[model samples]
Target: MLYPPHQPLQAAAIPPQRGPAGPAREDESGPWHTEAVCRRDEAGLFFAPSKEPTAARLSREEAAKRVCARCPVVIECREHALLQPEPYGVWGGLTAAERRVVLARRRRREMELKKAASAPRIAAAG
Candidate 1:
């Protein structure tokens, strides 16, 4: 019996690489990087919108927080913001007040966890 001719398989097309000009880099130490990411435009200013507002008033600070909320590198931004503990402006999707609330909550949780972890040691000593 004669064997059938082997069919050639079509190769997948590879996408062309664009030279440079990619998205902005996330710099942790650069001043502009943090400020630029948090800066609010004119529209964002003079408004105080809620996080999930339905026709709520919008303020400059709120707008700044909203913008940061959707940012790609928000986690890093938040970490930097936490380290700096900035008194004003938005960082990592959180306003100055919000950041303070988060920091407080974080500290409380850390203390709780530490206490729990040390409780066993105390019990063992007794």
Candidate 2:
């Protein structure tokens, strides 16, 4: 379920991947990445191993999110995660499930805007 923005994130989190530091320096690839707080954190802290208990997964995700909360590049991190549609891990202080919800909302809003924009044109044409 969705929680209020001010409410501290709880439950259902994932681990982040290890990558080079400081705003993803662009190389041959055009995409740029922001510095992630999780980079300094231990990998095990973010993700649970296979067959882990539900409680353990929840705890690990919570720990990862705590780190994300303190991150300076949180917005950038979140944008990257959302764009990449990061399949796993808590990026930008949000769990994967949370991101999915966010994405769905975005899609719905976009569709509404598009439909609204076209309505006038359709009427004009008619």
Candidate 3:
């Protein structure tokens, strides 16, 4: 699920890779990346090659999403992608096109909320 607009976006804070590492620090600083499955994987898996065909791109994106599915920082990654409006590759299991859709929906929802908030309410009839 996407992060709520009212709340500050926060890292998911999933458990660190097996074994004790003392208490996991709440303050993240490049530390949240230590547990990412993609760090040990190839970049090509997440990005498209030049002149890629539609079928190949689809296959590659699916593979990238699979990696993201098991990723620990998927939420944080997704938020980054959506907020940044990343124009390429897959992040948080969503392809570029998918991220566009999410961002559009979020923008519409925010607009609707703002509109409703400004509208005056009618008093109940006695």
What's the lDDT for all of these models? 0.50, 0.64, 0.69
Residue 24's lDDT in candidate 1: 30
lDDT of 3 by residue, 5-120 (tens): 11222433343432232233335544445555776677788888899999999999998888888888788677767765668888878899999999989899999999999999
Off by over 4 Å in 3: 1-30
TM-score of 2: 0.67
Off by over 4 Å in 1: 1-58, 121-126
lDDT of 3 at 110: 100
| Candidate No. with top lDDT | 3
lDDT of 1 by residue, 1-126 (tens): 100001111211222132133333335643224333333344234234347354343355566666666666577556656766656555666767788999999999999999898875535565
Q: State the lDDT of candidate 2 residue by residue for 28-117, as single tens digits.
A: 642222245565567677556799898988998898889888877678678777876777777788888999999999999999999898
CA RMSD, predictions in order:
18.5, 10.3, 10.0
Q: Give the clashing pairs for model 1.
A: 45-60, 47-58, 47-59, 48-58, 48-59, 49-58
lDDT for model 1, please.
0.50
Candidate 3 whole-model C-alpha lDDT, 0 to 1: 0.69
